[model samples]
Target: MSKRNRASVSLPKGVHRVISRGREYFYYQIGRGTDHEGDRIKLPNDPRSPEFWQAVRQAQGLIGQVPADTIGALIDAYETAWPGLPRKLTEGTREQYRRSLKVVRTAWGDLQASSLKPSHVQALIEKLGANTPGSANNVLDALRAMCRWACGPRELLDRDPTQGVVHFDRGEGHRPWTPEQLSYADEHLTGMLRRAYVLARYTGQRASDIIRLGWTDVDDGGFGLRQKKTGVRPWCPIFPELDTEMSKWERRPGPFLLQDNGRPFTTNQLWKVFNAAREETPLDGAVWHGLRANAAIRLRQANHSIAAICDMLGMSPPIVER
Candidate 1:
């Protein structure tokens, strides 16, 4: 392939030109010293053409006319400011927000934040609730936080659209696995699946944390780490059951659990394997997370106080109480 000639053509203060694949494309920057400073509006036309100039002026006019306090803009600003905030978002939480943001964008991305009515939010929630109430509730919660941030010292919005939007009741989530179900899983699950199950049951940690556990995490008759979801560092004594399970387990190169190819299990991989194991058992509605609940219940049965249980599970007292 011949080397393509590239040239920089000076345009307006906020506009520039670049050549890629022998085609010139123009980009207009929003401005300097703003959340979207580096963001550029791409104009897919010949930069020297009259149509291109017309398009640039039209885009500039639209940018000037549209308020910067749209729902999409506020979401961007909130994300840009999130890292500097006192309350930090966990990785899992950030991922959840990213997913929820897609839903929010689909509904009210371009709507002016201050002009959004409670009824609009309520309608979106109702529509989402019809199919996936839990997901709808999650989106509602995320939107509420974003709106609250907008309404804070920034005063991006005069009112919050999520102010009175009711979240659909999802009810108590995944239940604890019964002793018999636990025994069934113990007997039936093998290899990485069995190790993951035992680890989750013993540590009362989420699947994401449990799958990431390694030999380094085990020390001084216990294993501990700062949880990814909550950022709480929990050190729990290794139970006899977990010890026995680990004793018989073959050590893997990476994480405690490995896929057939010996790579550490991704979240989706672990879920698929766990679901396969669940399919073998007679237990219905028993998820991998249910083991965490089962572990908490076992601690409760052993007469551990709520506070102690909270510490063991790395959960807040309110959550454990719930």
Candidate 2:
């Protein structure tokens, strides 16, 4: 109770003692420049006990030994190297990898690539699958590809962490847009959004390819472009509906679908615009990609052969069959 007895006692530089409700509590700062920066560990036991010192020592050891070969580093290297390889990744595939890598980095960016075990990969997949199994599987695929790249060219690791890991079963698949939903969009969405929807339904191309369609791509009676995702060049005929939609807009030198400011839509911009229109309709569980499936189904309903469908959609026979 005297001033001399209450005088501060020395502890570790990063450790501090405080009194709350007349009880002393000890906490240790894990330090800066690490993933655990600003993190503090409270020692429940008495500071005079051996256990408290043991915990302190362990926390101190992790302070300045951050690993160099982190998951973030490996992903950065992979992104840089992937485009330069002889067999380069496609633009769409690269975008997919980038998105999945973002999710993985949020969870374990600073974690050492060499320290990852199959159990760690499995745990991540399980945690992600609880919310969205399809997304979990996509992340697993991205990790597997990154690990393979690291082993093959980067030589960052000798073994794959994703080797024994399995993906969650995403039951079923994307549903095709129904006629009623299409009608709803036609009535609700106007101008550029409507044209985009019409173009997707007619062409059966991915959103990436659709966004790149320009007036120059149009020819005598159809438009042709090499599909970005599959590398297949498809020349699809200009159906009556698509032609009618095109005639309503003045031809510009740029993309077929332009923003009000006369610029083509970036992938994100296109999705935002399309989703905004979609939200105004009475459809549920419908998506832009489903329009591609609708095109394939429409071709099938018209008694087209699998080969014809594949040619029209710029897809493989197996994908058409599916």
Candidate 3:
């Protein structure tokens, strides 16, 4: 909390200390020239202290912060170091990882990371999946991934506790969007709502890939991308249905799906907007991923083989069948 302690601390981006009087006052500032210009929030002086980060989170109005130890502390370290990791994670994938990690931290924050065992993970699966197997599988996958990351490169764990664990039977998984529901979405949805649906339904790309797509990805033949989740690169030619809609729209220099500031939407930001629009229509049970399933269905209906669908969508055959 004093100037001396902060002398050795490196401030995060957008944060700075001003020497007002004999004390160093820290503040997080944003939008130097934009409309939100001059926005600043005071922070604790000691950047080495957890209290400093707690104040940072409070300033950003972020949730799911715990200042304590064991599993919770490990999760915090992972969260902080993830962005700087060698692999570039898509915003949507980050959101997905965060969701699962939150579940683990909520239940076992007090447990030591090294104390985790397969039995504990299995028990957690049952407790989480007693009602929603799908959710439990997601949590299990997240925990396993975190443990794997912690084991490698970071060396935060001695071993993976989720090593022996497997996913619960999430029967049928996500319900693929029916033709009628998609039809409803196509007719009712407009602008980015329509663009988002069309991209997912036509390309069979996940929300992560969709958000990363820009006009630059498109060429004379199709749009190309290396999938965020699977790392498979697929060149998706424009479909007739999709071509008709996108052709009518004004082409942008960056991503087709843009926020007001001409920047691509983050996964959570797009979901809130996309779902908010979906609620106004009768497209019941419509999720962004559901449209990817619908894309496979369309491909299959056109006599494209399962192998082709798998290759195109960057999905495994088992998942394609599902």
Candidate 4:
């Protein structure tokens, strides 16, 4: 039982320290003149091991750095990251950015602004593509915008990783509902949602704008409201047919056509109820938003002037062409 036991050891020096193990350990420094802290750390076995602790040591260099030390800084870094951009966008566009932030936070929200790398951007765009093809390009656009905001106005990064990303389908811009489809949808739907759909077809307002519509906007068989998306104003005399429908709803509180729990509807929440309502209707391929596009296409088909369409739809002329 008295067999001798021995251990092999070797040490290296240079900005390094020694550590000991067992019941006790001793401190030693290669340079006596230096007043650095004691180096009696417990020696890790297999210094060449794949699990070596050197990685932790390497990270120690970044201990005292700030967000300015990396390119991954927060949204506040830019005085106007997308200042006028956000305002120019409609409430719907702002909501999209809010959603985009969720994905960014999940990816690298904690990293400093200066440390964001092209690789990180590429990875994020790839993931966006995988998760939501239709929205993937949009996410890429948002991320690129954030990076531009973070990178300063001088175009800091060598190449924007998201620059060339293509949409999942090039032709998915708009899919308008035909009159036959609208008729079928209306016949299938009843109550407020049907009327809402009718309004969407005529007004061409985005669901975001449509939900906020109220009785106050209507007057003498016509309605007037400021379009949120384009900041344009359009006043349309309600068609005689629609006028009859509005006359019946004089008892509701406030001005909005759609309501949630008796309050005005929000864009995010209305879709669920809209979808549920659609299931009962004969409408297929008719998304809540499709109503807006359908209305636009119909307006165009009716030879409504481009400017009139833009004002009524709250979109720019360029958007209408797109």
Candidate 5:
């Protein structure tokens, strides 16, 4: 976080400070009024800010050069660690990051991560978003995720360059279920609907993974399986909620959850049935995918850290942070 400089601020050589309307601003006036020199240039407001120093340096053509170790090195390190990282980077996401990092690498591979600022990020977003808003948002997500991961768990960077930056406002993707909506749905839930609801809520897994789970996968400890998206094998301990809900259900052979015909439900088939059941209730717009986000919210309400939730859900940092 950049804190504003209050008093006793220092100025670089040839830079003048002015106080107007009780606010401090900086300017360069060394060669002003000269035939060869252009008009005086106004500099950034905060002397302590990176923008302030960058402005001063650039004005004098004294731009500090990046050292041998650069943003490319950090991106390489992130790429190397991608496979074994605890957070889930799906196949598509891995490719997306690869492409996005390539773009960043091509743009500033020789530059230091510290050289990036919110202004640079915003400019990139504006440029890329001119054609495809989603593409711009995806690039920002890649940058934010990589920077956050570097700054947080990996300790690769002192600070996240993407901090204080905002991504494009992609509309609310998945709407999580409210407690009232979930509770009401529980009352109306039965058969596969009841089974799906219990599994999704308790396991904190997506519908694709949930529909795939069979009775053979469950154990005394919990449900154990490698998640479809992340390929992470997590022990999803059966919650008391699931236990209470399933106590009412008769345990059957084959898959733990099945259609009325007792066959396994495909992901699409499961969602169509689930959505139909949800329509009976007053709640609207809540989808099967929202259960994952709702599970995150529930765990967060219980004081779980974002990292813990991401790990538990096998989600990427970008998705979980959002």
Candidate 6:
């Protein structure tokens, strides 16, 4: 907070100390150019710590004109506005926002929110498309939600650059794993993979619910889970096989069926294992999520009504059709 501490602090090239109206931070060219100022910005936050500043300075030593304190204020404002939003988005929705913000940070970390344009939003959508169609849509949806929250009530985006983006046409819901694939998964998947996959295949529950399933949820032969994705609380008759599987593992393993390095498996980590199993499984197109699809398909095949499968999966009628 003193001039000595500030002076001893070396900044990236083009970055300088900026102190305005009792606030302090730093700034730099978010966009590259000569004679053009305010093209870039930054602030003192987790990402822009002293170590990062040193890296930037080493890369392009002592840049002129950009003020560091100003950048810090911008950083503060951007981060500050995020949590201030009023909406109580579901946990799944919050995760979506977090993922979207990561894209924004990676793309425009140096720019102030005022500097964001339709093109920046468009480019973020494009980068997201490189992954999956669903992921791209998620990034767009999350960004639009955040912008709306920041700009004010009523869909504040005039252009909504991501609005017109077309996602890939997925199949009429995912195809369930074939019999051979199921057999292979049963045989090949070991430890927690076996437990997780079996629960998914049997209950048709989302990964969110499946990971959080506990003894308390299991009553008599049916289990109760409030599906986080859909906010649906449904009681599903536990598959007899599921009971056998549960008996095999230690209970109260503290919430999650799978543990990695003694920590409960996160959805992200589950996907990683799922991807690996997909590669190994002869069922070429089936995903880890396809286990749920498999259960749905099996229920339908065994003469369960549409409503029954929907209830089991905690999906709405329309979602079940999709």
TM-score of 6: 0.64
The residue ranges of model 5 lying beyond 4 angstroms of the native Cα positions read: 1-173
lDDT tens readout by residue for model 5, 73-190 = 6675566456556565786578778888887888778788777877888888888888877788878888888888778654557787776767677765677888788888778777
What global local distance difference test value does model 6 have?
0.64
Clashes, model 4: 15
Lowest summed lDDT across 10 adjacent residues in model 4 is found at 1-10
Would you list the clashing residue pairs of candidate 2?
A: none
CA RMSD for every model?
A: 9.8, 15.3, 7.6, 17.1, 19.3, 9.8
Distance (Å) between predicted and true CA of 40, model 4? 38
lDDT tens per residue, model 3, 1-322 = 3455446455666777889778778898876557876678888765544456667766666666545336766766566555555586665567777988899989888687778889999999988889888889888877776778788655678898987778786576566887688778767787787788888888889897898887788877577888877677877778888888778778768788988777789888898887777675667567888878788788888998888788778888898877
Expressed as tens digits, the lDDT of each residue in 76-190 for candidate 4 is 2322223333345555455676577667756775575456666776677777677676566666656776665544444444445455554465455557786777778657767
* Winner by TM-score: 1
lDDT leaderboard ranking:
2, 3, 1, 5, 6, 4
Worst 10 residues of 2 by lDDT: 1-10
lDDT of 2 by residue, 128-244 (tens): 899999989989998998888678644788899999888886554678888899889878878878878888999888888888998899877888888877677887788898899
Candidate number with the higher lDDT (4 or 6): 6
Q: Runs in model 2 with CA error above 4 Å?
A: 1-66, 152-154
Instruction: Output the better candidate (1/3) by TM-score.
Output: 1
User: Which of candidates 2 and 5 is the stronger one according to lDDT?
Assistant: 2
3 against 4, candidate with superior lDDT: 3
Using Cα atoms with residue i matched to residue i, what is each candidate's TM-score against the true structure?
0.76, 0.73, 0.68, 0.64, 0.47, 0.64
Stretches of model 3 off by over 4 angstroms after superposition = 1-69, 76-95, 148-160, 259-263
Compute the lDDT for candidate 5.
Answer: 0.72
